[model samples]
Target: MNTEVVEEKSTKDRTVVRKALTYFVLIALIFISAIMVVFEVYEYRYDYRQMSSLLRNEDDLNAEWGRLLIEQQTFGATAQIGTRAVTQLRMYSPPPSDTVVISLPSTAQQK
Candidate 1:
């Protein structure tokens, strides 16, 4: 009877230890999962901020590109080129009396 009691007590002690270990492992896993979640949230926020900054930069670049395009068109105009030529290069067009016109015969007429 004494030996049976000792055996039962030992079994109960092992069961208690097992339960404690299981609980500890479960709590540790929960803590680790919580930390991972916090890290993920932080990383997500960081990425979002970076993306927003990139978008703003893209918008600025697009606006600059539009301005550049307008400037290009302004500079490439024929009137602007003619004005530059007259002012900078001292060039001018000849009078109508000095101009000459030549007409070429058509292929059918030649044939």
Candidate 2:
């Protein structure tokens, strides 16, 4: 009976130690998973911020490009070209005597 009691007590102690280790392992796994989740979230947020910053820069550049295009159009409009053509190049309408019409031949008449 004494031996049986000692054996039973040792077995109970081992079972408690096993349960404790299992709980410790579970807690450790949970902690590691939480840390990994936090790291991923942080990295994602950082990447998002970087992407947003790039998008904002792209927007700014697009706006500047649009402004430049508008300025170019304003400066290169037909009215401005007409003025420059008449003033700088001394261009004028063709006189009636200088007018002529040249017609293209049909495809079958090509050289």
Candidate 3:
């Protein structure tokens, strides 16, 4: 009878040990999953910051491009060129009486 009692007690102890081990494994899995979630959140925030910086850089470049286009237009205008020539270089258009026309010989005629 004592031997039977000892066997039953050992079986109960084994069952308790198995339950504890199962609970420990489940808790470990939950902790690991929480850590992974935190890591993913950090990565997401980092990517958002980098994207924001790139967008700001793109906006600055676009503004610079607009300025450059405006400068080109100012430089390339015919009126601006004529004004600069007249004022800075003392150039003028000739009167009709002083105008002369000279026609160059054509290549076909020379041949």
Clashing residue pairs in candidate 3 (N, C-alpha, C atoms within 3 angstroms): none
How well does model 1 score by local distance difference test? 0.97
In model 3, the Cα lDDT at residue 64 comes to 100
Q: What is the lDDT of residue 11 in candidate 1?
A: 100
Q: Model 3, residue 17: displacement in angstroms?
A: 1.0
Between prediction 1 and prediction 2, the one with superior TM-score is 1
Instruction: List ranges where model 3 is wrong by over 4 Å.
Output: 78-111
Arranged by TM-score, best first? 1, 3, 2
* Candidate 2 CA-lDDT value: 0.97
Q: Write the per-residue lDDT of candidate 2 for residues 71-100, one digit (tens) a residue.
A: 989978978889989999999999989999
Q: Please give the RMSD to the true structure for each candidate, in Å.
A: 7.0, 7.5, 5.9
Residue ranges of candidate 2 with Cα displaced over 4 Å: 78-80, 83-111
Model 1, backbone clash pairs (residues 3+ apart or across chains), number: 0
lDDT of 1 by residue, 60-104 (tens): 999999999998898789678898999999999999999999999
Give stretches of model 1 more than 4 Å off.
Answer: 79-111
Worst 10-residue stretch by lDDT in candidate 3?
72-81
Give a tens-digit lDDT track for model 3, residues 38-95.
9999999999999999999999999999999998898789788898999999999999
